[model samples]
Target: MKIKFFRTIWWKLLVSYLCLILITTVISYILTTATFRTIRIKERQMEIEIRVERIARIIGELCKEDEKIENIKGNFNEIARISGIPLQMLNPEGKVVAFSRSSHPKFRQIKNINLQPFEMRKLREGKKFSYTQYYGENRKKLYYYICPIYREGNFKGSLVTAVPLGLSRGFAIMLLNSVLIATIIAFILAVFLSRSFTRPIRRMGEAAQSMAHGDFTKKMKLSRKDELGFLADAFDEMSSQLKRNIESRMKLMGDISHDLSTPLTTIQAIAEAICDGVIDTEEGRKKYLESILNQTRRLSFLINDITELSKFEAGEVKINKTLFDVVEPIQRAVESAGFLAGKKEIQIEISIEDEKLQALGDMEKILKAIQNLINNAVQHNPPGTKIRISATKEKEKVLFSVEDNGQGIPEEEIENIFNRFHKVDKARTSGASRSGLGLAIVEEILKAHGEEISVTSSQQGSRFFFYLPYLDPASADVFLDK
Candidate 1:
């Protein structure tokens, strides 16, 4: 169970989220603790300074009474009581003159030392003093402040008040506990938040992995209307398109194989007949060989068409943006279709409102695309059927259409006529000299250059229309097939 959980993305996401929350919480706790500790120390120092100043006023007046050493000792007791802390006054000779607990015998033995930096500066200026960290006779830590007791603004003995930071230490410990508790809470929240944030991304990753494994059925479905949502929608669209392309390619392969197989099978029979001494005339052998060569050439053309379509799709075939006469490429396609028209006894008619209209695109590919449409109309029509070619410029776009007065496309299947390998009748399609990829190739080539190709038909005839973005005559390539 543990191994399975570890292998899954959702579990991994949850664990990672928890870890992030804990890390953030720990950082916050540390920062808060440090800030609180600094505040506490500053407050303790201020309290000690105030106590020292209060005691100094009484000591300076009493220390001047040369007759009352014992009275001064009693005054120190009063100082300790009022200050709410230990009070000790040191003389210039490093002897304790007045202090709480002065009767401890070691108090007289404990030696006074030079004042710390803050204390010495205060003493030199005859002002109140402060010490941030001080040590006592018993090696106890204290926060202290001192002041010079004075008369008539004259320097005298120093008065010091100290506070054992036992309470402050306890407060610090309490703060640490509070910080730890808060950190734990924050860690939990961070984990939850991080998991929530990463859930969509993780799903996307899974979807991508699935696609890599050739499963393009699932879509990334994120409900958020942010950038993630847009990404999810794009991913879904990509998957669907990928699936469709795969299906189309598979269908094309099947159709092409079926078409090629027939000719190949016939060639094998003809070869077997020649080996078995069935054909005696040189002309009959020549005809059989020519038929095989024709089929081979047809296969080559189909392969070339597929390759060119892929190039167009990949944008490897650059659209040569030239403003030339649209009539030029149209005439080229019409000329190419003439041979097929002649064979079928089909009369192709052409009409144009403006022959000088131009469009921006690759002329070669455009001509090929146009040729495919015209050839299709000519090939499928009855020998006497009239095929029409028309071109017009509309709103800065050029529309070229090939119409045929032949067996019209069925209403049900016209929509899919341009699909590769799709046949109105597979048996009829098989006998046809060309592969069924003609219109499919044309459609793809047009789409690659950001052009539009569509088919509309009625009971009378079918019209195939394609539009290309127009270019000004100044920029168009002028290819006149004179």
Candidate 2:
């Protein structure tokens, strides 16, 4: 599908990356400019100080030769023009004895020179002095360096030099051009990175669309080890699980229709046969009526099992837990299935490690789970098969097991035995009442109690076992009182 530009993750990631880069570039530009400006100003101040000292030494030499200021004024103007800085000759009394003429407009506006008291005192003491001041409408910075000129070991005067620290127009343009070029390069890189970041998300969206249309074959070929890779792996797992569930549901529907149709067709046929007088004799009629009744009962059992499994899968079945002697339910379940086992000549052996072993769970459900397991063994196995039922105390829990010595389950079919409507022996026609939901329901009952059931099978026999939390009789009473 063609996604809207602004609504896609690619567009959003691109915008976010560009915004971050832009902000970083602007901040970097401002800080860099400020830092370079400060360094340049310091360098200029140092250079001007050296020049002022040179002029001071020259003036001292001129004083030794001639104390008259006119003799040195021509040299001062020459030095100022060469250095492009204005110079002033100040006496000890803070008066400008001579000053250089400059072509610069700002220097021309200087009518008189007034030194600060501290600066004059330092010069009189034969030491150097320096200060900075701002001038004009733009507040341009000007640096002043004053060094003492000495003649015959006595302080004669001081020489001053003034230079502006304003940054040049050419330098400012160069910095701005560098920043613009860097920003363009950064934005281009951001575009590629954004595309790489959003590529997986786009593929996942396409995969989801394919899944919606019942196609489950698409795979994301990302091989990254980051969070995006983890998310992609999770997506693939979800898709696989969804496909399996859909296939399982389809199989379950077919199995249910087949199971229900058999009993229903038999009941319909028997009823119609009796109605059409096909069996006129009383004995034949009675036998046909009994067959119809049996079919109806089988239909009822299948519907009830299906409903019970639906409730368990939907989490509609609530477990009402209480502490009860585990052996009581085991014994009761065995006795209830005694009639069926006797009919099939299946021998059931009970082995209880402790008759007083107590477990915490819904007693009725536990009984039903045991009964289903026992009945399953009897119906599936041939006559004379022996089923062993055992309950034993194991540390903090009680282990219950049912083992039958018969043709064991195939290894490949063991994994699917707990799935609803899955029968190990698909060709068996003797167990007409079996709806194939017994093991599935048994599994659900144990799961609702926060336990798991496991099976191990060999050619000799198959054993199904599960554990339940055990409680002593004294503790059971204490719990009931609370």
Candidate 3:
């Protein structure tokens, strides 16, 4: 999708970077210019003071002989020419005595230089002073430095020097130009840097769009170790999970439809045949009715299994855990499956490490799980095969195992045996009445109890086992209320 320039991350980042650079540039320029001006002014003041002191000394020497002020006009003019600054000699009364010649028109117009009251006071005290004043219509600044002249322990007149206030205009222009160049360079870099930073995000956005369209194959190939890379990895994982779930859901729907439709079609056909009087004999009619009844029962069982599995998957099934004798459930499950085992001519053997061993879990669910495992062994094995059911205490847990000496499950199918509607090869076993949901129910029940079931199979037989925390009866009082 096309995104607006102003709303994009690149735009925001670029604007932020440029704004920072602009603010920094402006602040740096103001500070640097101010500092440069202060240093230049101080240097100029020192230079002017040195030159004014020399002129004061010259005036003092000339005045020892009581020479007139006009006689030293030539000296003042020469000093002004050499220093490129205007000069004025002031009497003790703060009036101009002798002034220098200058090429500048503004300085030539000056008839007299007046000193402030403070300046006069400082000079009267035989101290030097300096200050700044603006002149003319433009208000141009000029720096003034005055040195007191002394002769024979008496205060002579003061020597004054005046120069315009500023640094070199060429250097100032160069400094400003340098700052502008740097700002332009930084702005250019901000564009590239913002683009580099936002490139991965744009790619991820596109990948998300593809996912929205039901395409889960997009991969973000980013290798960075930053947060963005971590997000990309998570996104990739989510996509893979979504793909797997979608595929599994489709397969499950197909399995359910097939399983349900087979019995439904059979029941429908048989009912129609009986209604049409295809079997009018008493024995034939009774036989067809029995078949219909069996199909109906199969349908009911399938529906119930699907509903219960859904409850488990949706986390709607709460495990009501309590301490219960593990042996009681084992015996109950074996007895419940005795009729089915008898029909298959299978023999069940039970082995208990301790009859009093108790496990912590919902007793009803645990018994149901055990019953499913025992029935699965009976239904999947050949006639006359032997099944061993056992509960043994090891460490702090009770291990329940069921092993059947029948044609074992194939190695490749072992991993998927617990999946819903998954069945083994029919030609290798005898029973065909199972709905293939028994192992799946067992797995979900154990999982809800915070336990896992594992199976090991060889040419001899297959053994399914799981562990539950064993509860000591002495400590069972604490959990009795739960």
Candidate 4:
């Protein structure tokens, strides 16, 4: 269970944060306690040293006045009483002479004393020194200091001072309690912060699950300015894209069904009419058969275009690139689409500012794109309309255009003209069997070639144009001569 708990990021983060705070608090407690003990001991030692030196000085002055140890013992006892600190006087032979307890109000007898070897050595050296010792079953600790007494350069005795080790227990306890309380508060804050941080990620995970189940409506509600915030933004963008793709695909399916059914229904009706002998004349029958064929061809064209466009969108179509005369394919497209123009008595005009302009691209796809544009122009224009095809070398690229003197596209509708299944109003496309995929396919093909197609239309006419990279302008004369 502990292992499993640690495996979760929430628990891990909480534990990590808590551990960090706990370690810091523990270290601080140790340092604070140690420092307090050091400062308190030093203050106590300083007070003890002053008291001991005063007693030693008094004893030395009395001895100089010819006062014996027994005579000065009473004076030492009185000095210890006034100082309010436990003190002992040891003879030169290490025998106790006087004690502060002897003069205490509760006990009027002298207290016994024992000196360790190191302590005796410190006294003999007449050096002031301090040390800690523990006594009794509970090991109550005490800080002891020794100050030496001397008269006429002869060691007289030592005055010792003792103080309980704990001088500020109340302050120490308060500080410890404060640190512990702060640590607890920090742990609580860690829990809340970790949860807050991971909440958005958890929500995002659930949202992703919903998306996987075909529900893109669940969105994360997070507004933080961090890496996590950026991740949330990306997740929302992905959800939006998924929703759009699904909706657009559904609409495309419906459009495909309607478009397919229209041709199929026409073919079926024509076949039924011919089979039932509704058309008596053989010429009429032939016309009906041709109509069926045309419908079938139209159906085939739509399906093929749809399939090819899907491949192009999916990045599955490979372009075969080669350097070719830009005019060659445009010229071919003109001649092929000329018949369609001739049907409506539309004259096709061609122009080339640089006849030697060569471009690098897939010739077949480029030809198909040019033919699509020319067909679109021919179908939309009225009889006796003029459609102009022109190519010119501009800087490092060759600009190709197809302009038609027909009813132009509206400014508002221009942006979506290249969208699949998008068609202008029927008034602009009368008598044209437009699957509405021609311009879209052209756009995709040109895009695959690292190019773009755009349009500008107004009251006079509509011009569709794009640029292709030139194959080396310096070799223009060589290509022109070819």
As for candidate 1, its clashing pairs are 17-191, 322-476, 322-477, 323-475, 323-476, 323-477, 324-476
My TM-score estimates for the predictions, one after another, are: 0.63, 0.82, 0.86, 0.86
List where candidate 1 sits over 4 angstroms from the true fold.
Answer: 1-133, 137-167, 184-241, 278-301, 314-345, 353-364, 392-398, 430-432, 448-450, 467-482
Please rank every candidate by TM-score, starting with the best.
3, 4, 2, 1
Global lDDT scores for all candidate models: 0.72, 0.84, 0.84, 0.81
After TM-score superposition, the amount by which residue 372's alpha carbon in candidate 3 deviates from its true location, in angstroms, is 1.2
Expressed as tens digits, the lDDT of each residue in 94-163 for candidate 4 is 7777777734321223245567788788777878787777765767667677788888777888876666
The deviation in Å at residue 23 for candidate 4 is: 1.9
What pairs collide in candidate 3?
none
Look at candidate 3 and tell me the lDDT of residue 120: 83
TM-score of 2: 0.82
RMSD of 1: 7.6
Candidate number with the higher lDDT (3 or 4):
3
| Model 4 TM-score, 2 decimals | 0.86
List residue ranges in candidate 3 displaced over 4 A.
1-11, 54-69, 90-110, 115-127, 135-141, 148-158, 167-171, 272-282, 426-433
